[model samples]
Target: MKYLVMVQGTQADYEGMRGKPSPGSPAWSEAELAAMYAYMGAISNDLSETGELVDAQGLAEPARTRLVTAGEDGKPVITDGPYSETKELMAGYWVLECESLERVTEIAARVTRCPGPEGITDYPVVIRPILDGAGDI
Candidate 1:
């Protein structure tokens, strides 16, 4: 079965992420950045070895996002976006093909242990199984 692990955070968290110094900035330091990358890489490697990892990627900042909607007249309307008023915004995600929901949960648990930005750990990753078209709507 295929699962998608969605990473979500609050609007406050997302806003706070904007214009914050890059990890490599003199105030931030490269060593800290390197460590985070190393930890993520290790997890990726381990997943690959276990043959469960399908794909994963970090996303660009949310401010660059564009929102599209259908107008009353049914024309497309475009606007700048973080897209929604909700507190939660999806940060990134991973697609995994695993043997069972239990296995997917296990992988999510492991990923939750990985380091996050600013040395403050974050484990808001959410795992859900992909639904096929054959299932009831």
Candidate 2:
């Protein structure tokens, strides 16, 4: 089955990391940055080696995001970020073709070990099975 792993973060968590400088800055210690990169690299490499990684990517900053709404005339309107009222926002995702949901769960568990820049950790990964046959039409 194909699964999509959604990476989500709370508003407080998102804002906490916002406007931060680049990873290599003096404000970000080398050890911290290395841990983050190493964790991500390891997951990517493992998935690639196993041929389970369909797609994966980190998203750009939320500030660059925009929202579109439809007017009464069915036209679209553009707006800024923070589109939803939920505390958690999706940061990125990975689509994986795994044998079962258990396997996807295992992968999410492994990703949770990755360390953030400030030694903060968020189990932001969510796994859901894809329903390809939902629309028979």
Candidate 3:
């Protein structure tokens, strides 16, 4: 089965990662950021080597994001936003083909171990099965 494992964060978290402290979030040190990168890299590398990794990506800052919805006249309405200081957004994701939910659960466990600055709490990493019978996934 294929699974999407995701990590979420807020704009404040993103700012802190980029060295701009916002409200409750503190700026991350270079070493702390490097450690996070290395930890996530090791997980991705292992998944790739084991033929379990399908795809992975870290999304851009929420400030650059756009929202789209259907207008009353049936046209597309696009606008900036849906990001806030406290609202959580997806920061990164990994698509993995695993033999069982147990295997994917183990992988998600590693994500929770990613190192970061003090006062930074570990956000929950979600895993959901993908419905991909159409071969488009």
TM-score, each model? 0.75, 0.77, 0.91
lDDT measured at residue 40 in model 3 versus the true structure, 0 to 100: 91
lDDT of each: 0.67, 0.72, 0.89
Candidate 2 C-alpha error for residue 40, in Å: 1.1
Q: Which is superior by TM-score, 1 or 2? A: 2
Q: What shift in Å separates residue 103 of candidate 3 from its native position after superposition?
A: 0.7
Give RMSD to native, each candidate.
Answer: 4.3, 4.5, 2.6
Tens-place lDDT digits, model 3, residues 1-137 = 99999999887788899899866677999999999899999999999999999999998877878989999999999988654543778889999999999999999998998998888857899999998777655
Clashing pairs in 2: none
Q: Which has the better lDDT: candidate 1, or candidate 3? A: 3
Error of 3 at 116 (Å): 0.2
Model 2, 1-137: lDDT tens digits are: 88898886544444445434432322345676677678887898899899999998776546567889898999998888754665556777788999988899999998887776653435558898887796832
The model with the greater TM-score, 1 or 3, is 3
Per lDDT, what order, best first? 3, 2, 1
Q: How should the candidates be ordered by TM-score, best one leading?
A: 3, 2, 1
**Worst window of 10 by summed lDDT in candidate 2:** 19-28
Flag regions of model 3 displaced more than 4 Å: 134-137
